[model samples]
Target: MILVVLGTHELPFDRLLKKIDKQILLGNINEEVLVQAGHTKYYSKNMQIFDFTTYEHMADLYRKANFIITHGGTGSITMGMKMGKKVIAVPRLIKYGEHNDDHQLEIVKQFQETGHILYWSEPMSLSEVLRLVKSFNPVKFESGNKKIISLIKQFIDGA
Candidate 1:
């Protein structure tokens, strides 16, 4: 089971949902899908759509996924990385009207280059990424956020 999260950023990314099997669209597109002009229906043959959910639901879904396909949101990616789950970070490009900037592209690039994650843009590469995900190993991370704790201490001490 793969979890595909399209963040709640007022973007229509339902197009990508059709490509995967047994996926859940993590956003508020329930009756408002593809027919924002006042129509009410969104039935994709491949995926199930969730209008909205709580953080616990999100965490539960994340824990159960064999792989993850999500936007380049820091929270989502960080969660996936911390769990060492196979992930495909697709940036919401401005051309696609998914984002206001291309920062996601650069962010995903840096994460990929650092061997922390994998990213896909093209449909063909997405297929390949799907195949490759099963074999990708997530790096081991510390149990506690020591670096952030240290940073906060530095700020408190005015260091």
Candidate 2:
């Protein structure tokens, strides 16, 4: 199963949903699709979508998913990454009115650069990215909190 996550941002992210719907229509995606649609109001026969669900239910869905297609919010991306799931992140562009700003691009690019996730963007179709997923190996997720704590402890001891 593929899980699509659009986090609880106020803006509608119909753009991403439309692309996924198209891919499903094209038969590029042959698996069951479940979506946490958030504010995006879209109807698709190819997917099982809900506006929201309990945290535990969401986590269960995440665990059952073979891979994840997500909006470029930090929480959504990191959750999949932290679980060792393959993540394909699409940034919501302000020009499309999907977000108030293009800040999502920054985090998406950072994660992509670090080899934690694949990203879908212009000049590359979702099908193209999906083809690459067969061989994509994501780097294991590691939290930065431990390093930050160590640095703070060192500073205090040195003082």
For this target, which candidate reaches the highest TM-score against the unseen true structure? 2
C-alpha lDDT of candidate 1 relative to the true structure:
0.66
In candidate 2, stretches whose alpha carbon ends up further than 4 angstroms from where it belongs are: none
Pairs in steric clash, model 2: none
Alpha carbon deviation, residue 115, candidate 2 (Å) = 0.6
- Residue 155 error, candidate 2, Å: 1.1
TM-score of 1: 0.76
25-118 in candidate 2: lDDT tens per residue?
A: 9999999999999988999999999999888888898899999999999999998899999999999899998899899999999999999999
Off by over 4 Å in 1: 21-42, 142-145, 151-159
**Residues 1-159, candidate 1, lDDT per residue (tens digit)?**
667777666666645555443222432222222111011134664455665678787888888877677888777788888887877888878887767998988988888887778898755455567667768876654455888898899999995
